[model samples]
Target: MNNLRIVVRGGGDLATGVIHRLWRAGFTPLVLECASPAAIRRQVALCEAVYAGSATVEGMTGVLIHSLSEAVAVWQADQVPVLVDETAACVNILQPEIVIDAIIAKKNLGTHIDMAPLTIALGPGFTAGMDVHAVVETKRGHNLGRVILEGSAAPNSGIPGVIAGFGKERVLHAPAAGVLHVVQDIGSVVQKGQLIAEITTADGSVVPVEATLTGIIRGMIRDGFPVTEGFKIADIDPRQEELANCFTISDKARCIAGSVLELVCAYANKA
Candidate 1:
């Protein structure tokens, strides 16, 4: 059990929480991410290591690695490793004890029950006992982190969770397909209607994305990334004074991570 290897799909903020929890519990968790992830909360996302070579969240560091050997080296150093294996080819190579799909892509992007000895998925788009061994609820409600062993989590609501009584109002979406250019960095205080970012279309038409409510720039996509219409690009925290929240894992993320830890422990005990 001390040498258990966990492979996590995605390196976004939510996934990072699970990785952090697993690591603290004495598991070696490696992350798989795309060449360029669209994670808006880059400050807390381990996937940012793919672009920056290394990224730190809270007290943990995630180092970019090119191969399984390098990943093992990172593990020996007591650090998480991020690899460019979006389709999770390493699952077969590493033969990890656990596999977690934390992409939060709102749909099951090919994660199956047989990927590992114990498999778990976060958020919607997965059915317990079918798509994976367990499904952790991600929505902000009564079942936020409830482990579902026989059914699926709630469907995608398309509405962001309410903060300061503002549901969907705290999220910024791209108006059209183009390259995103952010004018404000995360943690910047903003007022309603303030221009935080803009999208440049093919013909050079600029579409401005403004703050829907007065708040702090909690998260925003990296500059120069291509975006499509209606794609989530930023998140504003209505608690204008809570700047530290930007770097720490959210309550929802921590709750879900705890669920994953429980599932892992349960499986290990059963074995």
Candidate 2:
């Protein structure tokens, strides 16, 4: 399609990557760089607009944010159908139709999700300018439910067990006695063996615990944050699975996908 306008925050390599993509996708990319006039001039020729300040929600006039928040807020236009995570860390912002946190895999910033929905892209490293990787498969669009985190195996134990994701999976009780140091909180993405808490033995021994597979942090036992032997930890997002470099949209549609979700999606990297 044509007439698509995207404003990318940050003028570094990441912004350039997204910009090139938007162009290929038929969208005009506007760069919002905090660099000097000369530094941006080279990129400006290919952009629709260039703002040289803190990208804010105010006066924001694009579909994305790569520079300032004020401009991003303004540009936070549209129903915000989806959030494509090209950023590095877990960004705690407003909300969108969907949030694709596809960067360097870390703790899931549960705060970044709002009513719409959350879906984590499953793949290798989470970084900038990668491809949108497709994790599991129930169907094409049907798989766009919960946000999946990094993990392998059958996906069972975690702060919240993997079973909890499907609302049917069962959670095995804690083995010994201890306080829940870091029980998986709702919204946190977890790995198969990631540290979820610190279980203390009756003998006064503290042991950091881990999960059994990859999934999103679904629920917790208490808010006080206890790390006990039998304390309930969290539920993992069941979306974790082996992902490839490309996925077919339908029976006759196909495109490229990335590990963390960096793609020429908006513009598929120009000529």
Candidate 3:
């Protein structure tokens, strides 16, 4: 087991995939996140620790920590620690050996190549050799997890990956701006045209958020969270036979996680 100090920014679903692999590989990874994370797949996201104090995904536990002391304690206990630091201010204090920006915000949020001895970023908005040491492909395709050493990943296509031949139809968006009220939660089997949620608009009138396709509720934002018109709020997986997939890391995420782990190991071995 490796005991390298790695600081990861973001605890969302995709970030959690990387964090999970790193922890399982013996690396002590500390996650940096915003005070309130907007993770839709709460079941598989380490950011859920922000609200529940701790969250378990596929047998890996992530604990919410505040200070350096708690971070070390969590590390010693073999649990990943999630810190609420959007700017990653703790990087200056912790001085970790490796830093990874897994925010998946589709744009750079202040991450730099000099943040650590070896810095890596996932997805677009980052140049491999300029903004960070390396960039991992996040767009679902033949190059999904390919590592880029000197260039940026593919640009965002403004579309979700196709699942079971259903692309945009698998994603749910808010029809109006308002507070969300969930009727069907994650992992629930939903049919097309079914009411899964409702949005309470400015006038207090509720608007129904229906399922666009018949499938399992793979993801859904927390109830009461404010959403804007056309904002992504849920996801439906057309494959109804794989219910456990809702709670497990996705194939795309695992592919990307493997690439991140490979890069970290490459650098660690060099040191």
Question: TM per model?
Answer: 0.98, 0.25, 0.98
Better of 2 and 3 by lDDT: 3
lDDT of 1 at 135: 94
In order, the Cα lDDT scores of the candidates are: 0.92, 0.34, 0.93
Residue 263 alpha-carbon offset, candidate 1, angstroms: 0.8
Better of 1 and 2 by lDDT: 1
TM-score of 1: 0.98
Candidate 1 colliding pairs:
none
Give per-residue CA lDDT, model 3, range 159-182, as digits (tens).
999989999899899999999999
**Model 2 lowest lDDT segment of ten:** 244-253
lDDT of 1 by residue, 31-123 (tens): 999998999898999999999999999889999999988977888888998999988998988998899999999899989999998999998
Q: Model 2: per-residue lDDT, tens digit, 76-146?
A: 34211112233423233433233343221223322132322333332233311222222221112343222
**Better candidate by TM-score, 2 or 3:** 3
Clashes, model 3 = 0
lDDT for model 3, on a 0 to 1 scale?
0.93
Tell me the TM-score of model 3. Answer: 0.98
Model 3 residue pairs with clashes: none
